[model samples]
Target: MNQRPDEDFEEDELELYEHHRILVDKGQSPVRIDKFLTEKVANATRNKVQQAIDSGTILVNGQPTKANYKIKASDEIKVLMEKPPRDTEVISENIPLDIVYEDPHLLIVNKPPGMVVHPAHGNWTGTLVNGLVYHFQHLPEMKGNVGRPGLVHRIDKDTSGLLVVAKTEEAMTPLAAQFFHHTIDRTYLALVWGEPEQDSGTIVGHVGRSAKDRKVMDVFPDGSQGKHAVTHWKVVRRLRYVTLVQCNLETGRTHQIRAHMRFLGHPLFNDAMYGGDKIRKGTQFAKYKAFVQNCFDLMPRQALHAMSLGFIHPVTKEKIYFEAPLPEDFSSVLDKWDNYVKHE
Candidate 1:
């Protein structure tokens, strides 16, 4: 897919205008029983033109009308323009990236919080995708597409952490295959409210789309599109009201850590979407409600970080590992928690 098109073939693929704007010339009275188009558009089949007129795409005197509307002499007419050859090319910019490791076949990056992994409706630019495209101008195809460039795995927008990107097709396939086989080592450090009774454990359940809200995921009672998601969490540190846990993903799913942790009664702190208002009291109970509130107010995103990543380097065929320390915001929260506990 990354193969460049032949020069002649590429030149032949030209963008063409869809519609034309024309004014009703003087003494040109409108008369349309059916099937008529202003001299601005082509490929307007009789049936489609009628449908367009019915839908009010055709306008006369700045007002939409059906196909039968008669045009008056010297009246203004505007046809909705259409265009062929949509822009499919992605532009690359030399945005600075936190490159943990880079080689001919792969690149590892510690993606910051709030950096979206891919382009979407509101985030077409300034994404990891855009950054990668810029960094590797001629990055080989991955997953049979050039748009993503080399995206082999993805973390949530707010989850800051190490991610391995394939630079070549050979690297992309193996990395992707490992992820499918659950061989890719991915771990997250999360500040979850409430301490689990157990020291370390696994949370396993079928995760599927939530029935109540399509935007969220829910644990399925009877498994549907729900796939088995597993997370092994070990308590790293216990705060006054929150516990820092290291979560290892056995099977990656949408919001797997967040949903599973929330299901296990330890939703990540300050996760307004899933943690709910009930978790607010923990911050309040710290005797620094105002301070905690201020800190939370200052925080830009979730309290989860991709702290550890281990994988086999595709080109060198050597094992590689990387880790990203918790960002300052999360660290500050922990520091405050420690201070409050010490005083108590």
Candidate 2:
């Protein structure tokens, strides 16, 4: 019989969004690992089960193993990933999408700020998935396993940028493998609160959901909690108080860039979740505060954008790239900062 998934974990190096633990019944028959897990995990497919195995995300008795491993009596199994419940279905929405590129296998869309990528608890409608469903009949799921159709990766709701969607399993499988191997190039532009001491640097740390606030993420430099995340950043331009920086994600985790920037004490401007909404730099003059407040009013969301994406075509095997210009809010806010720095 299949057992319940247990999340009983210590401060281990692994940072799985959801951890499933299974105990093989003493009378259990020997069965292939991939086929075995397909029955055990809810809302999971054989393809995903195989992907998890190939990615070394599935463990038997605490050690990564191959899909061919046979289950036995008294064996312990664990699977790690963000899991969505089986019964949930993402409803379609009439929201318009900003499609940049499309072909038989895949498409790229420039997601605007304030739109959720997928349907979740508080956000059910008006999501990118909702819009995609309206256009594409059905798309392959991503690593999140939340019915995020054709999504290779995702940006935050408040952060606007480019995203690619896979239209076929032929495109989806390889794209997922690319993201897992970190071969997909993802570049972001962010307006940070303070200047970095170094012009270019990399932030390495483990990131997990904050203990105090479940709504946001936190950096655990000690590696005691969270998953290993790496971000490389270089200053694109310095606007005196704030810096326009380009960030390259080496590993994609929940809020990796935002949390890592916060760890460096240069949170993205107007990022309320990480405390960037408050003025963390510059003078404390009444005029300065008011100016910052005005800037805040102009761009209420975090000042981050997915600037570019580069990856090999999952089907054609050809190198493909796409980019998006800064949205009006981000560009306008930067203009204000430039004017302020010039007048200073």
Candidate 3:
């Protein structure tokens, strides 16, 4: 059986549109276009294909066709859907944004730890995308991707950092391609429980959603499952119980740094999903536990920050780099650790 063409598409990057062009083989049997498309497209159902047909987004020989139309040999079939069907509309909110840089093609914003990058299942309002929509007119939305508009890349909600938004459609493709090719330079600073044995090393493994918990990621050491992920890490500073590590990502999978570090037995401090919320190191005494608890209170989220990002300009081909300083919560936690280490 032929593999679905979209199966080869990268999921980590932004996309402009959902477009599929197929040339019917000479030996292909006569089948309804909706049925054919449902089988040909990944994650496509017959109902969805019918919806596309009804919406006149599916064309045959450059003409919109009905769902029951039978595909013929040597037929040119094209499916062009501007955006996926969204159950909820993204309402523009007049929320403030900390835009670091802006141009005709793109803009860089420093997102705070709690703000959701885009609207999702539970977060439908007050997202960064909602703010972008209100701040900028006509921001481009990713094709087949709903909720996130004008965004080329996103940082996790609890991970404070820089994110690049493509203002124009022309800028989205190249920026997305840079991420897909692993040419974008991204560095994250994380405070992890326990120091790594080595000063610097690379962690290579396949990363995917965990089987036990679908919300979190798990590393596959043998590369039997998930996407290939690589994180080069070096110790920045060593506290008594935790270490500050700088991580450079070679591949940007979901929760790559958090999962990889957890696999290395040093999950990010206060990363609840990866089991870093509790004290992983230090004495088990009541005093030590209270100190750790206080530190967690200072920074309620994961101790991970996207410190820097570098990428080539989509139009000018010039290289650009941006950095975001650690947020107050993360900084306060670090200060507490520093003081504890100094007095100890």
TM-score sort, best first: 3, 2, 1
Query: What lDDT score goes with residue 61 in model 1?
Result: 72
lDDT of 2 by residue, 1-344 (tens): 12111111111122343368999999999999999988988888989999988766788997778888999998999886644334458787778899999999999999998888877655677898999998889687744364667776677788888988889988987877777777888999999998898999999998877755544678998999878888999999998889999999888887888889999989999988889999999998999999999999999999999989899998889999999999999999999999999988
Cα lDDT of candidate 3 equals 0.83
The TM-scores, one per candidate, come to 0.72, 0.75, 0.76
The worst-scoring run of ten residues by lDDT in candidate 3 lies at: 7-16
Question: Where is the poorest 10-residue window by lDDT in model 2?
Answer: 3-12
User: What is the descending lDDT order?
Assistant: 3, 2, 1
- Report the lDDT tens digits of candidate 1 across residue range 171-209: 877777677667778888998878889989998888765
Q: C-alpha displacement of 42 in model 1, angstroms?
A: 19
lDDT for 208 (candidate 3): 73
lDDT tens per residue, model 3, 179-277: 777789999999999988899999999987664544577899899988899999999999978999999999888788999999999999999988999
RMSD in Å for all candidates? 10.5, 10.9, 11.3
| Clashing pairs in model 1, backbone N/Cα/C closer than 3 A | 18-82
